[model samples]
Target: MAFDFDLFVIGGGSGGVRAARTAAATGAKVAVAEESRMGGTCVIRGCVPKKLMVFASEFGAEAALARDYGWSAEPGEFDWKRFQTHLKGELDRLEEVYRSLLKQSDVTIHDSRARVTGPQEVALADGTTVTAKTILVATGGRPVRPDIACSDLGIVSDDIFGLKTLPKSILIIGGGYIACEFACILNGLGVEVTQYYRGAQILRGFDDEARGLVAEAMRERGINLHLGTNIVEMARAEDRWEGPVPTASDAAMSQALKGAASPLARREGGAHRPGEAGPIWVKGTNGQQDVYDQVLFATGRTPNTEGMGLQDVGVKVNRRGAIEVDAYSQTAVPSIYAIGDVTDRIQLTPVAIREGMAFTETVFKNNPTAPDHELVASAVFTQPELGTVGMTEEQAREQEPVEIYCTSFRPMRSAFAGRPDRVLMKLIVSQASQKVLGCQIVAPGAGEMIQLAGIAVKMGATKEDFDRTVAVHPTISEELVTMKTPMRTA
Candidate 1:
């Protein structure tokens, strides 16, 4: 059957872009429709801008240490507006780069919302229909707010990048990487940051020891970390103090400002006035009431599969709205496929790119591929980052007997400067196979250190293999090699 294009990609995210380009490079006709920006979430909203903020925030501590090192360096107030301007410019440049790549790949770009109309037909929001031999869905995910009163008074992680100004004090909700990272970032930027996590500990899936140390360090850094606590109620801080904004809920506010340049929660319902700065009042699980300049909710993310006509066109999605895809990223309908966050397989950007490449290999090159997800190294960019790969000690113990090797001490530089900060290095080894099952590092450069250690773990390197290597003297990572005895076996 004749079609408008060989492939129609529904998202311009990392996965969709990669798939579109690769398929186009195979001499297949390709067209991509992106409702928002070209570079999708990571390039535009998530990782890139967040990392830049992380870098911007860390300078405060760096300046503090400079004084101890005999260098006269004084930390000054952060000019958030200036940094925000530069950040927006950088994202704009990157979006242009993405556009250039798609053009170079000979793929058509559509700046409109698109949905699967039929087995091989795509309907654009502008009332245009395009047919394709195959359709790819990679719309990714969005931040979600929990159900609570006056939640609209809060913002999500995506809104952080779009904030016109940083608040002087913020109440951060949740304990995931997003919450923890931003808690550190905002605190470093001289904001009074209070973090509330209903869970017993933060970074739930990470190694307990590593995350515990992180929690400890965050507290030491004046984060006002609160555990086993959640917001029970919320209200606006008007002179008379009424309930939530009558017009918009926090969820509505998040949705309305999903992709805006500057996202401010404006109340647009009943008695609430739009464009007014409504300070939020909250009551916590522990019976505490306080008003914060900003309330940031990093509770979780949900797949972007709603109102895209997926179900109408016969694509299956789970209750949580994540697309159901096979190992090859193929949907129930052979003419349709999904990847990346929409599929809920792995939410990492790198994983999405890998899935896209694998999809192209299978569909275009006739060489089937499944993206490898084993022993994936990941880092949480909290102050003194946490980096890990392979299994956690708890995970290893659940599977088999494990030997744990761990150390914690003040690093040379921080110690020399009389700072109380300490670094942690830990390795989890399989007792039977003598293989190093996993490694976690908590330090300033743990993210970089874990990348190299991940290679060894991915290769199934054993404890003996690490012992055989010579130490890079006086380096924090040398501990990965020099630790000879297991601290405990379980």
Candidate 2:
């Protein structure tokens, strides 16, 4: 049988792009199809733009700190339009860079959505079919709304980048990092931010003490943090969305009950038409009712494996739409494979790229490599950032006895300014092996620090190794090496 190319990659995300370029280097023909932009999520929407916003949002606090440091400084009004213009330009440049990389590798770029038609065939959104020796599915995921009434009245994280103007006030729903991070970002940018979480704590699944400090920091910064709270009813005012109301999957869910009796109920309009621009009416779980300029939903994300012909072609898809794949990134059908968020593996960009590299090695280089997911480091860009690598204290104790060393205090810089801001540094070590099992830092620049700390943890550095290393004088990170006693043993 003849094929159009040796490989057909269904997404242009970081994972698919890397795999296509690497596989093409092996003297194999490759083609990548993307329905939207060339750089997919990270470069186009998720990390790149979000990080830029994070940086922009921090300037207000930085300026205030400058004043306290004997420098005349004041935070002026933020011009969101100006910042958004620059953000768009930067994203455009990155997309071009991605296209250049693929072109250099001699890989074909199809600007269309694609799906598996058969074991060796793929169908594009344009009604064109292309056959290949192997097909790789790397389409990532998207934010999902909860099954609540008038949910479409709320926007998802992705919609944040596209907003023309920043709202004066917003109600963010969800306790995850996305919701919490945005709550801080918007508050820093001078928006009145109120967060509602259904759970008892925010940033669930993280170290409890670390998240507690983050929540406290958020509250100190004026974020209205509500725990064990959710929206009971919501609707848009009659005069909203002056332009086109949100539609399709973006529309808020409209339930049958309009004038339902509820303690928290407030009705300022007859009905809501998806995508309209009037103020949003809300009834919260605590019997509080009010109007908000915007309501953002960061509840969760789901894999992008639906309606793309996967199940029709006998490819297995889980209930949540994630494609099931082996350690080698191969699917049940020998010629088909999936990786990145589409597989619901690690859901991180770096992890996805690693999986793609491993797939290239196994399939093209004959190296038979599998991605190493252990000790993966990550950061949350909250007001006071959090960086973590390795196991949590709870997880470590469940596996074996462990020793924990931790510290919390106001750092020198903040202390000098008489600010109440404090930072935390923690280390988890195995009692028997004495090896550093995990490290977590909660403070500004924690993300950058974790990258270096992660290298030591990955090498299985023991407590003695850290003790012998000379400490940098007058630094927060020096605490990592200087902690002499286990605060507690688990």
**Tens digits of per-residue lDDT for model 1, 37-103:** 9999999989999999999999999999999999999998899889989998999999999999999
lDDT of 1: 0.88
Worst 10 residues of 1 by lDDT: 254-263
- For model 2, the superposed segments whose C-alpha errors exceed 4 Å read 238-276
lDDT of 1 at 377: 93
Q: Which residue pairs clash within candidate 1?
A: 151-250, 152-250, 247-269
- Model 2 CA lDDT for position 187: 94
lDDT of 2 at 208: 83
What TM value does model 1 have?
Answer: 0.93
List per-candidate RMSD values in Å.
6.2, 4.9
In model 2, the number of clashes is 11
